[model samples]
Structure formats: structure tokens, C-alpha cells
Target chain A: MSSSSAAPGRGDGAEKPPMRDALVAAAFRLFLERGYEQTTVDDVVALAGVGRRSFFRCFPSEDDAVFPDHERCLADMTAFLAAGADDEPVRRVCAAARPVLRMHAENPAFSVRRYRLTESVPGLRAYESSVVRRYERAPAGYLRARFAGPRDGALRADVIAAAVVAAHHNALRSWLRSDGKGDAEAAVDHALGQVRAAFGAGPVAAAGKGPEDVVVVVSRRGAPLWRVVQELETALGRG
Target chain B: MSSSSAAPGRGDGAEKPPMRDALVAAAFRLFLERGYEQTTVDDVVALAGVGRRSFFRCFPSEDDAVFPDHERCLADMTAFLAAGADDEPVRRVCAAARPVLRMHAENPAFSVRRYRLTESVPGLRAYESSVVRRYERAPAGYLRARFAGPRDGALRADVIAAAVVAAHHNALRSWLRSDGKGDAEAAVDHALGQVRAAFGAGPVAAAGKGPEDVVVVVSRRGAPLWRVVQELETALGRG
Candidate 1:
């Protein structure tokens, strides 16, 4: 079928909005029906009733089509962090993650489809990791800038950014694995809350004390009572 | 030049040790001289005095050649964690990271060369992320097993595992960026120490007290005195 005959509303002079949507819809349909690897650019264009040129203009590659607006979401997140207030770095990073979560949550079916596709394909999984690394670097870089002074500031920034991203992924994946039926917002909020508590981003650290005054400690469960008392005494003495 | 003429000692009956070493050396030399993309498996084989079959046997692909022993290293790490005692999960995870760090540190020249190549090539970077993810999952899985009871056990496992891996990467990257010239052992020690401190693996939580009895609050520096006082009062009251 020719482009004009197959898709009546689409023409050479038609605006980008419907054409883009049609292309994405068609591409996803083909990917789901025939598998991501089996589907070709020609197949997508034929199904969408658009020319090859229009397809390329919309998506640089087949993989690009699967994640059409990641770049935009990333840019939005960067902007959100760039405009963040100086004091609440953890809050800013967590907030920066919202757009990404919403991007997945808003399109439950598409996100779930893409998630399954990525899970099955090693190449797509690598591509997805690269995309996730970009999202992680954004927050890490922002936190690195904010945490410029201490010796371990860069390290702290990186690990916390990684934790935030990991939490976001954990929540998003759980929701996706459930076929997107549950309350995603609550899941994400609970996940991010765990991150905040684990990282200790409460009123104390957020108030901006130097590192010398704060000595956080972590131990495994079920220590001897005497050991706990001794450690507590040491910690209290240090404080 | 023919394989026999270029590498006099290599032949069909030759043992695997020298052939593997020769192939790696030849591949690295070519990758450095001509760039990674510009070098091919044929070039590597011809230079190493090996046939195509041998190259494929030793390494699945050119990218795989760049990271020859990651599989072995990952296996070693997994074994290390698997044999760990039940009480010290953090220590076990941190110890598991040492093999990977040692793998890079023991062969500084090759590690640096590969690091530079990965930095220049987007594909290699993605490949590297996949490799790193495997390492991250090892500890995350181990921690998840240990933290099985708590509601947020899985989340804690993943984030802490991410933090451990991030600290390892941060230290490793810093060492690599410095051209492998540094007290890498000390750098890693300090980095992991920060992870241990920030995550709060202390005596109190390890002693099995409920969340209400354990008032582990983190406050910021430069908080209003009254706010700090009020928080302290509230925490004390709760405890």
C-alpha cells in the first residue's frame, strides 16, 4: 500500500504531531507482533503509512524509536536539577527522578512492552544501561557540584546518585513486572523514602555541618550485647 | 607477513599460554596504534601469528578480548561471597570487590589501555556497564539473601550493593585516570570506609532493637539551634 492510500490523514504536508504518533504506534505494533529484531525500518514505515525520510526524521534508528522521548526526559530532568535550590540536594535528586518515573508510568502498556523487549535482548539491555547511566550521571554530576568541598564528596555524590537511580529502577521494574496494575506513585515514593532514610538525608545532615562532626556507622544485625555497649560508648564519647 | 614468519614460536602444537598472551599483546598494540574500531580480528590474528579459529577460541569477539578475564574475576567474586559467613554481609561484599580491584591493579598497563579504549568507544562503554552490572548484582543478590526479612530488605540490598560497586568504581576510575599511579589499596580502603560509615552498619541496628528504640538521626551542620534541639527532644521522647 502506498503512503497516501494506506494512511488517509497523513500527507507530505501533514503536521508532525499525528505523523509522529502514528509512526510510534505502528512501530510498537510491529515490534510486538513480529519481535524487535524481526521488525525493520521499512516495515515500520509501511505500517505507519509514512515515507522512509519521515521515519528517519522522527527516529534515528529502530532502537531510538522504542525510546522516543528519553532525550527529552533527560533534558527535563537536567533542567529540574539545574534550577534546584542549593540546600535540598537529596530532595532535588529525588524530584529529578520523578519525570523519568512518570515517563514510564504514564504509558503503562508501551513501557511494559519495551521492558519485556529489553529483557529478552542483550543488545537492548546494554543500550538501556547506557541510557540509565546517562540519567545517573546527571544527578551525580549535580551532587558533585554541590558537594565540592569534602575529600569524599565526589564519592558520596556518585554512590548516592547510584542509590537514587537504583531505587527508581527497582520501583519502576516492580511496577512493570506487575503489568503496571498497582499504584506506581506510592511505590516510587516508598522506594525514594527508603533511599532518603538509608542515606540519612534528614534535618541533621541537610543542615550543612562539616564532616568531622558527623560519624555514621553501620553494622550487621545480631551483635553481642557487650559489643553494642562498647561501640555505643565509643560513639557517644566521639560525639 | 605470514604467521610463522611474524611469530616464530607459534604453531598448531603450541601450548595455550603463550598464544593467548601473544594474541592479547598484538591486539593491544594494534588497538593503540590504529584505534579500536580501525583494528579487526584478522589484523589481530595476523599480528599474533594465530589463525581465525584460535582467536575465536580464546575470545568470543574483539570487545571480549579487551576484557579477557572479567568472567573469571566475576566467578571469583561470586565464590568469595558465597563462602562468606552469615554475620558479616557488608564485610563479605567489600571483600568480594577486592578481587576485581586486584585484577585491574595487578596488570596496570593492560587495565589502563582498556580503560582508555572504553572511554573513547561508546560501544565499549556500554559493554563495560554490563560487566559492571554483573559485579553489582553479585553483592546485591548476596545482600538480598541476608536481608530477607525486613520489608525493605531487597531495596536496601540493591542500594547498598550499588553503593559498594560505586565506591569500587570511583576508586578504580580515579586510579585509572591517574594512569594507574597511586596507592590504590589505600584509596579503595578510604572509599569503602565512607560507604560503611554512610550506610550506618553500626552496633545499634545490628543488636536487633526495633526502629522505635533506635533513634539514629542524622542532622546537618549549621541548623538553627532550636530546630536541632526540637529534633533531639522528639527523638529522645520517641526512644
Candidate 2:
């Protein structure tokens, strides 16, 4: 998407430690200077002062270098969830969602840059979807394990995971739209809190009295709306 | 990715007034027979016995032809939601979600084939994400409009939309994993019902008193957990 290809970073920050970081930084430098598809691994290694083995070691493809922090963030999130005590599951997952938002907040310029770069390329947009799906799986795995007993546990896990991710992104979008100048943590916390309020163990459960006696209605699956309403009315003793 | 590149269909079902459908059928035959990359617009037109204009009229890109029915399904869903009269919005969105699942169910083999085809191609998988986003936006738009009053209304709408979509797909995946042989409607209804339970205007409201008085514990937005719990216990007169 950038206008022209240029020789980028001839021996800039070549002495950096952690060969992986050097390769990714150099890749992003060249990737921005000389569009995504136009740059090659050879070009990246030359600027990075690393070997092709090192380049491949750091990135799957040129586009993948744009998101260099997801693996670390995902690992930290997994470890955080794994170390958690038996807190409420919905609250726990909402807690687990913070590290991801914080990861983006840590480097607004980099994320903003990557955001614009990704929006410009169809291939990168596709690649972004794959990256997102990877993050979605972590919370989903934790919830699936926690909610394993119910028949709908897996479905619940998937829905809650998706809700968390969607809410997280919704908040992040506002922060990024402000060019990363807004309070990301507050926005994300507020958004995830909404998810918790909806899916969390409710005030009824928190009060330690069961919710069933309040009202209960049962209807066969695939019943018509009228029939289901009739069943509910009958349950309320009003039919 | 199909194995080899070869010429495909010549004048099969050319008389169909639904020129769009024929063009897509022809494109798929060639895309599967040859490779997706190997097939070109010119080749598709030659095989379908249609002019180049017709092919371009029907699809945006070569990959766009795969999801032939989404626009129609989206229109039907939008109309269904628009026509809904004063129903509970969460349940309305869930009810609105069915036609999309049914659209896929209407043609199991075609969906099964598209599923396999999409999985085999990364670009198609990316395209699938865009298509799914389109569907997600429908429920999201409806919810945003309906819940427009509160400050968090938009965020609530978004996460709920994502939850419904995730549940819908979870059930759809079961049906698709069965090679589209499973009962998609029953599965989807069950999944969406879970969403309804989580987000519905509860039986408390149905019992005709607002849900506000069940256990009201007011706390500041950014209050610490202990402070909030202290406030809650004070509200319950146990402080």
C-alpha cells in the first residue's frame, strides 16, 4: 500500500540482542518502507543482519511480522488463567481478557502502524483474521474446561469467548480511533464488564438463593411460539 | 488447491434465466476441476458460454462467487427483523438468526462442498470471515438501534451480536461436521436459546416488577472489589 519500494535500514540497530526481535523490527522497517508484498526475506535479512534461518525462525510470512507480540501476550494470558484460583468462570475469563488489551496499549504507535498497514492489504486482513482466531482459542479452552460438565458447556464456552473478544475489540477500536491517545484500559474494562454483567453469575446467584423458584417454564424443542407461550402461561398458573 | 489445470465445462445449463446462478455453477466446476488460482475470468466466461460482462456483473472477485446466497439471506434477515413487532430484542435477534442457518441447510451438499473448498484455501477462509462479519453486523445493527438509550448500549449490542453469531456457528459446525447431515435447525435453535436465556429480559420482568429491586447494590464505577462488596453488605443490612 505504500507508494514505492526503497532500500530500508542499511545496518540500523543491527547490534540488538535477541535475534528474533531484531529480525521483526527490521522486517517492519522494510515492510513499511517498501510495501508488504514487494519486500522479500532476503531483503529483511540484509537489513536485519540475520540469516534466512533466523528470518524464518521469527516470522511465518512477511505479513506475520506486523503482529510480533501476540504469541507472548497469548502465553501470558494462558499462564494467568492457568494460575487462577476457582473464581467465578465468567469473571475469570473477563479477567483473562485484560492482558491482550494491555499488550496493544503497551505500544500504541506500533499497533496503530500495523493497523493501517493491515487495512491496506487484503492478504494481511485475511492473515489478521487467522491471528484473531488464535487468540479466541485460549479463552475458549479455559472456559470449556471450567464449564465441562454441562451439555451446553462447549457452546457456552465458545459464545463467552467470542463475546469477550468482541467486547475487547470494540473498546480497542475506540482507543485506536483516537490514534492511541485515549484511556484504553478503562475503555476495555468497561466493555468487558458488560460481558460479565450479562454472563456472570447473577445477583440471584450471588444472593445464595436459587433462581428456579422465581419462575420455571418448560416446552418441547421446535414448538411453535404460541405453544411455547401457552406452556409458559400454564406454568405461571394463568392459563 | 486442486491438482491440475485443465479446461472446464462447455455450455452446461446455458439457458437458465438466472444467469448469475449458471455463472457461479460454471465457475465452481472449473475452480474445483482445475485450481482456484489457475482458473481465470476469461476461462469462466468461455466455459459458461456467457459474456465477460455477465461474469463481472455477478461477482466482485473470483473468490466472491463462492457465497452465492448471502446477499439474499441477509435481505431476508433484515426484513424479518424490521417487521418484528415489539418482541423482546434479544429474542428477536435470536429468532432472526434462524433464516441464515436454514439457508445453508437448504443445500447441504453445496454447503458441504463449499466448506471443504473454503478450508482447503486460505484466501477462501479469509473471505469466509468477511462474509461472517457481514452476517454479524445484521444482528448488531438491530440491537444497536433497539438498545440506543444507554451509554453502553452499543457495546452491549456488539457483544450480544457476537455471542449469537458464535452460538449459531457452533451449532452449524456440528451439522457441517456431520457432512451437513445433522438437523441444523434443531441445533441452531438450541444454541440460540442458550443466548436467549443469558440475555433475555428475565422472568422477573415477566412477573411484572422491574429487576431493579431484586438486590440493588450501588457502587462507584472504578471502585475496588472489597469496597464494592462492603457497599453490597451494607445494602443487605449485614455490614
Q: Specify the highest-TM-score model's number.
A: 1
Give lDDT tens digits, candidate 1, residues A18-85: 77777877877777678878988999999888999998888777777778778778898999999985
Model 2 stretches with alpha carbons more than 4 Å out? A1-54, A79-87, A119-123, A202-239, B1-23, B26-54, B78-87, B202-239
The candidate that wins on DockQ is 1
Q: Could you tell me how far off, in angstroms, the CA of residue B220 lies in candidate 1 after the best superposition?
A: 8.6
For candidate 2, give the docking quality class from DockQ: incorrect
Model 2 earns a TM-score of 0.70
Query: RMSD for each model, in Å, please?
Result: 8.3, 10.1
Residue-wise C-alpha lDDT for candidate 2, range B167-231, written one tens digit per residue: 99899988988999867999998898767655653222323434343343433333333233334
Q: Which 10 consecutive residues of model 2 chain B have the lowest summed lDDT? A: B3-12
lDDT by residue (tens digit), candidate 2, A18-107: 666666677777767888888888998888787888777777767666676677678888988887758777778888888788777766
Clash pairs detected, candidate 2: none
What tier of docking accuracy does candidate 1 attain? acceptable
